[model samples]
Target: MENVTGLVEGEETTAGEAEFYDRLRPLVASYCRTPRIERVAVIGNEPLGSSEERAAMVDSADLVFRVNGFRVDELGSERAVGRRAEVVVFNRGVRPTPWFFAGYPERLYLMIEPGRLLWENPKLPEFWPQDLGIVTMPNREVVLPLGKALGADPRAGGQWATTGTVMLWIATRLFPDAHIDAAGFSFVDAPGQTSWNHAYGDPSAVGVEHRIDLESVLVRRWIDSGRIAYHR
Candidate 1:
């Protein structure tokens, strides 16, 4: 565990880095004690047909996990996409907007891609959430090797797993006893289309690189084995 200052990208360390890590360490320890739950929902931002039954099913889960740039507002939201998130995962490349923290007020954990965030956010540790229960890192050392082993493309210099894929993996590891459910994730685009990017931006809008086909293959395997209950 390197210090947060060294882990995040920036020429100079910000004042908040030390204090934030100081508070973060103890909180992370406590978060590990979270009681086992029967179900955990991992939400993606893919398009879905709105259904009250689906929404109620997601809402009924004991814990919910959402990835970057998801909507929790009432207006124009589907019932299947619940309003609450117990844990939120973020990509390092995307800076945490005000809405990111706002949507997870009761956050039990704030999972982040530290190395990527450091490279992407040149400002380093500025404008971060201080009140979250715990800050967890999905380190590249863990992500890259595991993703490669799971058929992720190695051509991108080992950075290929999307946030949804990472979230799925995390849910399995963290809540082994819980039934993992996922929604809003369809790895392929429409017929005769290129890769289907997430709901947050236009296709190829960001510099982040990933192999959607490989991720889709892996996800499909997980679905087949009943590891992930994907909302079709």
Candidate 2:
């Protein structure tokens, strides 16, 4: 893999190209252990309608993954969304909440900046912790192939995969043997819906950068193929 420097612009001391791959190697090994991960949960930010059993299942998974701006305690009840987040995947542009950084050191953070493939530099948010190491997915290695698989036309304008889809893709690739469960993902069902119903904040409109129609098709294919088990 080629090295891309300056993950956070103007902050030269933080881990750049070398550190990213260094961290990724061990992280992959840790999850892809012998006997394999029994169950892996990829929790979306959408509300779970306070289903206690569903939330419990998410918490019980061997690995629980969450996306940007996820809320656990703030949700007030474990029924809305589980309280376990071992891995957090976010887009480079996301401005995560304070609670999102609560247990910063312990969680595995992966930033997906597909723009980096175009030689674009990433600038971290002011709230980003300086000590945190950045483990970014290689655009050519992960993003491009994934985009192609989902029918993305790189030649087209502003067509990119959402962070949630990227997280699911990563989980499937890394833990091939584990049974993957996805919860709170309502986009596929309502591709025409403009706003997002999150577990934490008010509803926000979908961004122009993402093509929900394209993602919905891919996700539906995954569900039908039994690659991942979907939960409301």
Candidate 3:
């Protein structure tokens, strides 16, 4: 609705973004655990928001947190921009591109896309057992407390030490009756960087391909194992 001018190219044009948003809307409704998303966070080099973006979010997302460092002026404007959103965009990129921000929860779903982030970072496995990989990572890194000192992307792997694990992790502090669903190469068990690249299209769309069957595997394990908290 509001004319989105001056957006970075490649997923930045108004028509382009509108199409992306159009694709994203029903996709979430179709794929997510619920018609409404409870709450969500997406941390990346860039930030995208629209009034309908709020409506597009599955019904559960009462609040949406966007964490990005690149756009300072635009950051503050997010609140005003997405009038329909109970949204907040944090300006965390004062420094160079490092890892994901740690000011949120302890454990989360770090969206490691295979496009932008991986492209900029030729170095793979900067950190070990990274929050999640752009796609498949060496099986060795998938340990508990999720290892930190490994060979994954330093930015991604550093999260385990800083707060938890990931170049970026998006999770809910107040989780509810929810289920987990993620997509992409890792979700389907496709291996290698090439497969990851082909399957996921773009690395910046971390939150996109992430699917979950975690209600049984991850959530049940985390809560029942006394590993994580499940609250209202």
TM-score of each: 0.69, 0.82, 0.24
Candidate 1 vs 3: which has more lDDT: 1
Worst 10 residues of 1 by lDDT: 1-10
The top-ranked prediction according to TM-score is 2
What lDDT tens digits, residue by residue, belong to model 3 across residues 137-178? 211222211222222333353222111112212222122222
State the lDDT at 86 in candidate 3.
Answer: 24
lDDT of 1 by residue, 56-140 (tens): 7677777777787765535575564766676777664454534467744556545555345234443335556565444555354
Q: For candidate 2, lDDT tens digit of each residue in 9-109?
A: 22122244335445564585464323456688898887767778787888778888889888774465446677778788998777676658888777888
RMSD of each: 10.0, 9.1, 18.0
Candidate 3 local Cα displacement, residue 104, angstroms: 15
TM-score for candidate 1, please give it.
0.69
Whole-model lDDT, model 2:
0.72
- Model 3 ranges off by over 4 Å: 1-37, 41-60, 70-232
